[model samples]
Target: MKSCREATRLMSESQERRLQLREQASLKLHLAMCAPCRNFGKQLSILRGISKSYAEGGPERTED
Candidate 1:
């Protein structure tokens, strides 16, 4: 099993889909067994999602 720190570090530098799968799996495993790490992973995921939205323009789309 990978440590939370190690998993988080991998997540930080990971970009490709395959790398993300491994990082996310490690993160989830740690989070499932550790409350603190769960919070940490949740925050990181939320932050990443928010940042991605902002990078792509934080606006709602409407169908015409």
Candidate 2:
């Protein structure tokens, strides 16, 4: 099993390009078993989507 550090690294790296089949398998296995890492991945995906929205001027988020 991959360590959290390694898993996180792979997660980040995946943003840039496609991972190999082995890497994909390892990351999937790790994310399945690691709740924290799974949450981290979810949050990362959300943040990325929000970032794209901001860049595209999709909407303004009012601060209160």
Candidate 3:
């Protein structure tokens, strides 16, 4: 089993590049058992989406 630190690193690296099959398996297994890591992964995805939206000019704001 991978430690939380290792699992988090793999999750981050996966954003930049494709992980090996073994790495993918390990990360999947870790996430299955670790709630915190799973939440972190979800947050990472949300942040990435927000960043992409911002890069694309984001949503329009109206004066209230």
Specify the highest-lDDT model's number. Answer: 3
lDDT of 1 by residue, 1-64 (tens): 7886886666565533456676678766766787776676668789888999999998798999
Which 10-residue span in candidate 2 carries the lowest summed lDDT?
54-63
Clashing pairs in 1: none
**Strongest candidate by TM-score:** 3
lDDT of 2 at 17: 93
Each model's C-alpha lDDT? Answer: 0.72, 0.96, 0.97
TM-score of 3: 0.91
Q: After superposition, how far is residue 28 of candidate 2 from its true place, in Å?
A: 0.6
Candidate 3 segments exceeding 4 Å error = 62-64
List, residue by residue over 1-64, the lDDT tens digit for candidate 3.
Answer: 9999999999999999999999999999999999999999999999999999999999998999
Runs with alpha carbons beyond 4 Å of true place in candidate 1: 13-17, 20-28, 60-64
- TM-score against native, each model: 0.56, 0.88, 0.91
Clashes of 3: 0
Q: What ordering of candidates by lDDT runs from best to worst?
A: 3, 2, 1
Compose the digit string of candidate 2's lDDT tens values, residues 1-64. Answer: 9999999999999999999999999999999999999999999999999999989997968989
What clash pairs does model 3 have?
none
